[model samples]
Target: MLVHHLYSGGKDSSLAAWVLTRLGYEVELVTVTFGLLDNWRFARETAKRLGFKHRVLKLPVEVLESAVETAIRDGHPNNAIQFIHEKALEALASMPDVVRVSDGTRRDDRVPFLDLPKARSLEDRFNVAYIRPLLGLGYKTIRELTERLFIVEIRESEELQKADYEVELRHLLRERGIDPLEIFPKRHYQSRVLGWKSL
Candidate 1:
């Protein structure tokens, strides 16, 4: 029974794994490499530091680009990110050692996105858990938890460059003048896409 954490090698995702470990779940970190993530060292180091298993799932940049490009070609350019997240989830769920998939989604983040059920939709029929221990806690709180646990060192990223999807979407969001929340669907964070409650 391999428990997987939705790791982005960023503060939020890393914090999610940290919190879950304290809660007594057997957690491993999964880093979905989308773009030029020159190195996968962060996931490896963080997992080793926290004593959790880590794996890198390399998503083909071409296929990912094709999906987004197709959605754009179909006239829903703005929804590219939504498709990207969906793509990531589809790929993430296929791995063998993933009994549970956990993410760094937060309490403050839930109200807008209502992501609980979104996470659970990836669950396998075999009873895998999609966990989110930081569902109600904000970025600040997650950071606090990290600091309290003396894991702040994980936040330092030495990446040579940012992920392309991250850069492009942020630019689009800026151009649209919509908060990132607008891009996030306000859906449940579990198996059933029940309407979300702002926690």
Candidate 2:
């Protein structure tokens, strides 16, 4: 009954984990890091606030390097970001006790999404369930739910220290003297979960 939720300490993923718990599954917030930064701590903190068990998984650094190269070659981070997400899902599915893996992919999200083919492939290859609690929910509904259920802090992606892949990707890009803003979109807002709102 334990489900590993790909958590980024953001509203959508946080809400997704919460919804999974409501549906009678024990949710564990799993944050993936590339060892490029310590931003995973932010996710651990939010997981504590939600009272969910949390752990950090370190992915191969070569994978992150490849993502950075893809972003540079494509002049954007969409596919590169998606690449990391898919890899993360695969990693979670391959874990010893991971029978079900979940992510916060929403209806309107373009990047970091699992298409039908990929989801089916993962489930088939690993004999695991690919769950997306927020897949059927749009941005508006997700926002409303988060507003009612939790306290959230919103800011520009560059300023926010959430545990999403973009943060590490951007950091690697900056270390290579390539400005992340050159590839990432302008005015992208990211949210961080602070605590729950009591009814």
Candidate 3:
């Protein structure tokens, strides 16, 4: 199946991209730029280094209000970040060969969303399955993978350190014991397990 890996330019997403490519899947790396403001140069650079086709989509923060509302109604503390992925996936649905949208979700993230009522098989949603190559690993494991793979220069800009409103909100949620990052997708569903690392 044609797959597109969601590239966040972070250690987790980069490691997931590497895993997908090495497994012999025809995977493309896609990053959704928030407000056209943050140009994920890291994701782009990683895609270049790994030689994977990279795609980007710009999303307005306001465009995600409905998603935010839904998430909030569901008591999701990191509603904004979930809204970001909702917008990102919506944008991806418009593209071609999007049979699967791969993510960097790990074991912990599999809990909430995977068990939520909204959790449908990927094929049921985007005509694509959402794959998570690093679902078996944790943040530490992802970091170890990056070191082992010799991943270089994948840090975000200082501007993003304090500028990403969603990430900041996620931090707040983290403090409240929500841990928003845990809701990110994963690759632990019923499927032929395959390793897709490229570098």
Candidate 4:
């Protein structure tokens, strides 16, 4: 069966796509963007390196607006990012061709983690399977696997323009005369898949 994996060009999502491929599923990497930036192209490049079909889905700009508003209200990006993640999943699940939707959300993820209740709701509403290939793996194990299978470039989120939701959120904040650094933690590092480590 075919599975669409929400990819951010990061190690976790790349590793999740790899795992889904090995499990005999035809995996396609899909990146969600609000059209504010071309960051999704970075994810498309990474998908090419991993040999998975890739595409970009443009969500309504209101999605980013809502997320940014939430971040501004909460004084942190956590809840806002989680809100965007769930919305992205919902969009993917509702696609006519999508029977199964997956993401890189792991046991250690806090911001974009989908709990059992939310996952069940998604599945029940869309009549599609919601899969998390890395759900059972923690950060350490995911890192080990990614290290062995791919070459990754890691840097502070502001420094790396990968396809994750944060980039557009930051841009929107800046456009509104708000500094993203105030909402997003400065210590956060984002990864972009460079290529596969030659086996």
Candidate 5:
């Protein structure tokens, strides 16, 4: 079966895609860009390095902005992130020849996660399966597996600004004279993968 893996060029997503590939699935990497400002260079480069077909899907800034606004209004980003992920899945499911959708979400992932109800709903709507290979793995396990499978260069989230979907939304909020920190929790650390060691 063909799997469209939601890739962010992070360790988790990269590992997830690698796992699917090992499982004998035809895997294609898909990265969602919120606006024109944040070019997904890292994601594209990682896909190239891994020898995977990659596609960049441009999502309207307004759509993500609306979700960010709602999350800020609600005082938590989980809902907003989940909304964006679901929307991404919907977009991928609509693509021709896509039989399955997958992501790098792990057992500990709070945001960008699909609850059972939502997963069931998506499967019913699209007649496709949603897979998360790392769902049962913890951070330590994922990190170990990543180190074993590929040599990766990791950068702090802030340093890799605009590499993540939330970064664009944060920038939008900041441009509008709002403080993203007020909405997002303090000391939230995310990472980006620069490149992987050649096998």
Candidate 6:
């Protein structure tokens, strides 16, 4: 079956894509861009290294910003992050010939996680399977496995301005003269694979 893996060039998403490949699925690495700034090229490079096809989907900055604004008003960035993820899934589910959609969400992931109810509804609505290969693994295990398979560059989330959903949203807010700190929490981290070495 064909699987569209939501890729971020980060450990979890990369590992999720790897897992799907190992399971004999034809995997395509997909990175969604919110039309402000993005590090999607890194994800494309990682997909090339892993021998997978890559796609970049662009979403309107205004759409994502609305979600961020709502989340900030609600007192948590998780709501904004999850909103973007759900929208991404919804977009992927609408694509022709895409029967399976997957992401890097883990059991311990609080932000950007699709709850069971949402997952079921997406499946029912789109007639597609939503897969999260890293859903059962914790951060420690994911880190260990990633170390063995890829050379990664870790950085503070704020430093990687276009690396993930939150960072991109922060950039948008800043461009509009709003303080990101007024919305997002402190001390977030992000990772990207520099290269992969055979284990």
Which regions in candidate 1 have their CA more than 4 angstroms from the true location?
35-37, 66-79, 110-117, 124-127, 150-199
Q: Is candidate 2 or candidate 6 better by TM-score?
A: 2
C-alpha lDDT of all candidate models, in order = 0.54, 0.94, 0.56, 0.93, 0.81, 0.83
Tens digit of lDDT per residue, candidate 1, span 1-199?
4567656455566666656767877777776665444345655665565566777777777655664454445443335645665555567666665567666667765221325466555564435666667777766766565555543322111222222234344344444464434443333121111111232
Candidate 2's error at 161, in angstroms? Answer: 1.6
> Would you list the rank order by lDDT, best first?
2, 4, 6, 5, 3, 1
Candidate number with greatest lDDT: 2
Model 3: how far is 174 from its true place, Å?
20
TM-score pick, better of 2 and 3: 2
lDDT of 2 at 103: 92
- Per-residue CA lDDT of candidate 5, range 127-165, in tens? 889999999999999988888777666544455632457
List the pairs of residues colliding in candidate 6. none
What is the per-residue lDDT of model 3 for residues 1-199, given as tens digits with 9 covering 90 to 100? 5677766655666677768878878878777655434545555765676667877766664554444445445665355555566556656764675667777667776322243333353446666666768777876876666766643442233223322224434444455576454532222111111122455
Give me the displacement of residue 127 in model 5, in angstroms.
1.4
TM-score, prediction 3: 0.64
Residue 131 alpha-carbon offset, candidate 4, angstroms: 0.6
Clashes of 5: 0
The local distance difference test score of model 3 is 0.56
Q: What does the lDDT come to for candidate 1? A: 0.54
**Candidate 3 off by > 4 Å:** 64-77, 94-96, 110-117, 152-199
105, model 1: CA deviation in Å? 1.1
By TM-score, how accurate is candidate 4? 0.98
